[model samples]
Target: MNHDHHMKITLEAILPSHAARPVKCASCRTMLYTTQNDSGLCETCDEKHLNTLNFWTAAQKWEELVEMNRWFIRGDTTTAPYHIGRLWEETDPLIAQLLELHEYGFITIDSQPEMEHVSLSIAKKWHLIKQRAYLTCVLPTRHSLIPISKIDGLRTNLLARKDLLVTTYCDNTTYPTPKGQGLQDAIPLTPEYKHFTDVEKRIYTFRSTADKDKDVLTKWWEAKTRLELKQGRGKFTESRTFWANNTSRITKKGSILTGPDDGDFQAAAAMRPLVFHIAAREWDAGMEVVGMLVKMCKDMGFEKTFEKFEVELED
Candidate 1:
């Protein structure tokens, strides 16, 4: 981690009502206005209003709350930057709360404005390290090919907590995977270059707006075609294919990014679609591409492949 990076985060300020528009003072009961500087409270109370701003700024009470929120979720001591924290000074209470929760670690935050749901960071450590876990897919080349007796040993001592199985087949060779199916318990998956070409790659990309799963199924159909040809079956011939075609479309135009303003709850909630994308692949080679995807997804907490199970292959 980079010691130079300081986690700077901000909390929103709760200002007096009509601060933006000038209103009557609570004490003087005079109608002070901003447009004319003629309504609301008198000049005497204006000094008090200035003092209020000064007090809030000095207390940094909001910052304290934001930091607390981050700790509650991430259990990390880091936070966003100073400028990001300052933005909340103009925001409302709900927005302020959300920013604090985001800074702590409820979910990943992107600061980019163009990307919807983006999160922001004040500072970050630049150190890098690597570790291994079970439920991870590895390629065949990396396979240790343990004995049957050691299955329990591998599961208990080596395997990660989540077992992910993803597959893709040609349109013709595709078949419905049985419910409750998962990666092989005895054979752990790994990443290998040789297996990449064997991918039952999807032919079309899934879109949330229209005909969602149809594209995925269409690619499945392409994969199945290869399997059918091997069995001497002909081209696609299904009047009942409509259901398979449209199953994966997303009805809502969901955000792909999040930030401190979204809070921990919403940030976590936003990740479901992203994780689904990786999970829904037609087939997984255990250690090949699927393994690569899993490694990325685990860090993302499952958003890598949750949505958009469709693809458009290049010629």
Candidate 2:
């Protein structure tokens, strides 16, 4: 409105520093020594409370360096993800790694949205480290809902459903044993128990039979085909379902159970490990079966796929 006053303001803006030198941080009011601030934090407070770039993982940094370098090699350096300051807003490790790469001068981040979008896409496809059974709660429970530290006993002689109740302090706890059948160790299901333990979602795939028996795979294939054919464009009913983390480590983790993960058989068979459906019921038959397999492997001799086998029961 006033041309002379406006000219003075414009001259001041061009001459003065953008940030004002404050004695203390605007947020925490902590003492500021070397840092010249305009309502900003000191280095310590910045890293503790606000800095997201400070939490980079070494492995992820190396990886993003590779990825961004690939883009750099294509003669395009200024992409959205590389320039996004938003990527360092939260303590996500993947974004932290990206920030590290940017700091290293490989990436020149220009925008926020591309970095956020790209980082999120990478996060979605990221895999979790799958856990096999250790203190696995068998009692008709999903594996993810069972907290790793909450299980009571060491990994030896674990039962899922039959009266084996560990003392867990669930909210508003009440345990009632059924009449005449006598399930003193029956676990009570609670809303707190269900939701409180759902920490991380892990994924698993196929597990092999104990002896690497092709028969099991054959049966799986044949039965799956038969059942699929029998279904005939209807909803499939899987009578027997088996799941394992992988085909290896049958010796380390227990032999893969051939039945359902949640086979509430009204007995000890109701819980984790899910080994009720084994054809050979006797424990001696277990050794005999393994021995025969070992003999076969030994007869086949060295230079085979397996170096050796040891029957170990570990978590």
Candidate 3:
């Protein structure tokens, strides 16, 4: 859940001066020193370029200048002999470009909860940028966790069964309901009481005492729902329930299920809910789906509201 408030935009490229060449300032046309003209501009002209409000226009011009000065898309040499000065300063020009982009709905900016920022490598992966020299802008974000409380609707039905196997209900017909009669009512009086009725009943003894147990169960349900939304009914049920019955060692203590062996218990108990391990296994896949959605938004070149993001979960 860790994310940064500021989205960092980085402009990186092999400047025109990366190759051995005498480049001139594209703006001022000044005969610049080799080190001073690496960016195809002298310090004064570079400052002026950064001062401009239009990033797209400036970027196009910068690309042209780099091409004019023999900037290579890919380089043969591993190292450059001279230093290329910073392309744009963090002054008014950079701010103006960011503001323009924000105003035009090309990027979004909002306050986000404090958390560890995503690493540069991760950001590059998310953005699908492989080029060495490119512009990146970090837009501030307002991100919040999808509330796990919705899982409450599924809790009683899911946990009430005697079998430890996890099950997914796609329709209301197969879904369980709250035990309205009595705990003793769950025990059938006769082996012949197999008549079909309006309600489907399967029950087990449940002692709902541990808050931690409920938390893990909530996470488990959330993961299941996300999987269902991403992969649809068939794959979600098949994949998530792969090891559902491998719970021979699990014993119920209150509402929490503890593993039979100390090692298993330790692993499960390390987290609040014993089911967290199961959910975490699917985390990467779920995040991949999320990343795909983000890439889609970027490609569409629009800022979406939080509700729009929620709509993506609709099954």
Strongest candidate by lDDT: 1
The full ranking of all candidates by lDDT, starting with the best, is 1, 3, 2
Model 3 pairs whose backbones collide? 7-138, 7-139, 8-138, 9-136, 9-137, 9-138, 10-136, 12-133, 12-134, 13-133
Candidate 2 TM-score, C-alpha based: 0.14
Q: With candidate 1 superimposed using the best TM-score fit, by how many Å does residue 210's alpha carbon deviate from the native?
A: 38
Q: For every model in order, what is the number of clashing pairs? A: 89, 7, 10
Q: Once superposed on the true structure, which residue ranges of model 1 sit more than 4 Å away at CA?
A: 1-14, 18-53, 56-112, 115-315
TM-score of 1: 0.16
Alpha-carbon RMSD of each model: 22.9, 27.6, 23.8
- Tens digits of per-residue lDDT, candidate 1, 1-315, equal 122433332222222223344554543343454433342334444443343223222222222322333332232321222111122211222243333323322122221110111122244212111111111111111112222222222222221323322221111111232334221211112222132222212111121111223322111111233344445353333221122222211212222222223222221232221111212223222332223433443443322111111111111
Candidate 1 vs candidate 2: which has greater TM-score?
1
Q: Give the per-residue lDDT of model 2 (tens digit) for 148-236.
A: 32222111112222212112221111212223432222222222123333321111111112221111110111122333434543232
- For candidate 2, the 10 contiguous residues with the lowest summed lDDT are 200-209
Model 3 CA lDDT for position 8: 22
| Per-residue alpha-carbon lDDT of candidate 3 for residues 1-315, written as tens digits (9 for 90 to 100) | 112343221223222222234556554343453445455665554543342211212222222212211211112111111212322222223333333332222221111111111122322321111111112111211112212222222334334433222322111011122334332222121112244231222221222211221212111111223334334331211111222222211222221221222112221122222121111112112222212223433454444322211001000
Supply the TM-score for candidate 3. Answer: 0.16
Instruction: Report the backbone clash tally of model 2.
Output: 7
